[model samples]
Each structure stands twice: as C-alpha cells, then as structure tokens.
Target: MSGTSAGAPEPEGALEPEGAPAPESAPGPRRRRVPRRERERQILDVAVQVFAKRGYHGASVDEIAESAGISKPMVYLYLDSKEGLFLACLRREADRLVGAFQGAATASGASPELRLHAGLLAFFAFVSEHRDSWVVLHRQASELSEAIAAAVAEARRAVMAEVADLVRAGIAEGGPATQLTDEDADFVTHALVGAADSLTDWMARHPDQSPEGVTLRLMNMVWVGMGRVLEGEAWKPVTG
Candidate 1:
C-alpha cells in the first residue's frame, strides 16, 4: 500500500463512542475562567457606568467587558447575559442606598425632624457620591426590564415606608398641626419621595450646584413646607 493511501477509517460512532468517554469539547463562552465574585463586581461597576451613559438597551455586553478590562466570554461566565448584569447592578446600588439610609436612621437618637434631616443628608450625599450608580438605578434600570423596574419600585416603597413611619411619629408629637391620617401619610410619603427624586434629577442636571447649597435649599423647602402644611397651610397657584 502506498504511504499516501487513505488512513484506515475508524469504526462507526467513532466521534462519540457509546458508554465511552467523549473527547472534551473546547470551552464555550460560559466556560471561560473568571473570578466569579470579582468579575461580577467589576462587570457591575462598568455596567452601571455604561448603562447610565448609554441606557440599558443601547449598551452592550462587549462594551461592558471591555470597560472592565476583560473579554466578553469572561463576562458571560460571570453574568449569564446583559439583563442579568443590569439586575445585578440595580440590586447592588439599591442595597447601598437603602443600607446607608437605614444606618443613618438607626444610629441617630434625634427627633423625627433630625432623623429626616440626617437621612436626607445621607441620601443626597449618596446620590452625589454615586451619581453613575444612582443614574443606573433611577433612570436606566427603571426603563429597562420589568425585573429591574420592580426592583426599583420595591426600593422606593421601602424608603417611602420609612418616611411614612417618620411622618406618623411627627404627627403624634406635633399634635393636630402635624397630625396625619393613613391616607395623609401615604400621600405625604410619596410626595416627599417625588420631591426628593425631582431635586436629585435637578442636581444631576446642574452639576455646578454644590452639595451644601443643594442640601440647604432642599432643607428650607422640605422642612419648612412640612411645618407649614402641618399648620394648616399650603401653597397653591392662583388662576389668572
């Protein structure tokens, strides 16, 4: 037989022998090596910035991985997909904000107003410090997947509940002037959240505004407004 003759053919089912060990396939995207915890954190950090800047859908896993100084396959190994990455980012930032606020509240033995002050100050400080994170949570995350939206909503509800509890305590101490029923507490809590959210949005837009300046302005508006409202006073626009 000539040396150039074709090699002997293997028996049938040679590629994958029955009840025999199959040759290991090369790694797929999911098989890439990465430190799961570290990679997940890095991906979340980069994803928040990317998603904040580009919005969720506009941003891609490749960009996030590149931003994190890794390959997309590595990112896939840590985070199953883009949606998973986004949810991870949302959860982290939400936990951070909630934990900070809760800590401020728990640590303070001050009055309700003081507690509110501490919490709000902590909140503004948090949002200012983590602008990208806040943007991811407040804007991009909310607008993306429903899972993300629900997470954001739940965080909001938690903050609102805390505010409602504070309001109830305020009503009890301040008597009729600051008194609030269940309905009033609900309305005020959401309104306060809305107001803080709006103010944060405005702060994000106006980066030139100092934190102290922003805090002072909000304090005057919020604390004074609450005091006035509890005293049977409110601001209303007059019709032309």
Candidate 2:
C-alpha cells in the first residue's frame, strides 16, 4: 500500500527502462575543452615528434593529427599545412635554443668568459636533452623550401648575433687589442655555430660524455682561442 504505483510520477534523473537500450548511458564525461593556443601547442608537439621521426616529405598530416588525437583537418586548421607545421616546429625549437643561450649568457654577476661558457654549456645541454628538437631543426634543413629556409636562417642569425655580441664585448675588454669589427665577430660566430652543429652528431655518437665536459672541451679549444683572437693574436689557418 505504501509503495508507489506503477504509473506514479517517475523521479527526475531516474534510470531508463530496463530493456529500452539504457538511454545512451549519460554521455560518460564531457571532454574538457582545450583552448586554441593550448590545442595548437599540443598539435605542434606531436608534429615535432613525427617530423623528427619522418622527414618533411615523409611526414603526414594524417599521422600527426592521429598522434595528437585530432583530425587531419584540425591539423590543417591549426597549422595551415604540413609545411606550416614544420615551420612552426623550426621556429619554436629555434626560439627555445636562442632563449637558452641568451638566458645563460646574460646571467648576472659572472665574468664575461664564464657567461659565454655558461651559454655554450646551455647549448650542449639543450641539444642533449632535446634530441628530437635538434633533429627537427638540424636534420630538417635538407627539406628546405623558401619559407622553411627563411625560418631556419632567421634562427641561425639570431644565435649568431648573440655570440657576436659576446665576442665583441670580449674584444672591447681585452687591453688595447679591442679592434674587432662586426664582420670579424660574425666570422667567429659562424665557426662556433658550425662546430656546435657538427658536435651534436658527435654527441649522439658519444652518449657517455656529459654536457659539462663537452662544453669545457669546446671552450678550451674554441673559447680560449676566441679570447686570443679577440686580443688580436689572430690564429691564422695553417698553410703548407
């Protein structure tokens, strides 16, 4: 008598009829919305991994999107095209590399030489820790088109300028021999960057070598020589 009748009003949010297909099971949980910028970054992160693993021509928007758990069209929507995605990876990695160098080199209170050493150490550390990023930035050069080349060049120039400034500062301080020009500084920058670029490969071959050791060796070889050059000693190339 006290129990509700069969036709009594059903409570709100009650279960569906026993055999009536379970009313679609309440939609599990809503997927939290990712903001556009965050979504783009997530897409880019997956893109970098794929691009690193597969060169530009080989990498596909489909795989990158799937890896990112998104649709291919969504990748295009976020990055425009595969080329755009590669460019984005290049720029982001380059910015990160540049930021690492600048942040280390500009560190307060250390001597100029130490700051420069710190910067080089930071470079090696970054390359070591971010092998995929380095691969994307370094190895992807072979796939360059106009925009890709330009993005790569821009990153190179930014790093060169930072090193050149340090070189110029060193030249200014070294007594009476502070005659280094911007051109001279750039020449040094090219050599240093080139060597560092090559060393990334060497680093891959020698995983046991620590970044600090690598940095020290490079500084002893290059930075010491750099100081001598800045002081106008001029270690000219050997001629037979």
TM-score leader: 2
| Model 2: lDDT to the true structure | 0.76
Q: For each candidate, what is the lDDT? A: 0.72, 0.76
Model 2 C-alpha lDDT per residue in residues 56-109, reported as the tens digit of each score: 889888888778876676666556667777777787888899999999999834
Give a tens-digit lDDT track for model 1, residues 1-240.
111101223343332212322223455654434333444566677888898898887898878877887667655544557777777777778888988887887677768877776777778889999999888878776666677688789888888888888876776676854555778767777777788888888997899986667767776776677677778886789999
TM per candidate? 0.77, 0.82
Candidate 1 residue-pair clash tally: 0
lDDT of 2 at 79: 62
Off by over 4 Å in 1: 1-35, 176-179, 229-240
Give the CA lDDT, 0 to 100, for residue 63 in model 2. Answer: 89
| Candidate 1 similarity to native, TM-score | 0.77
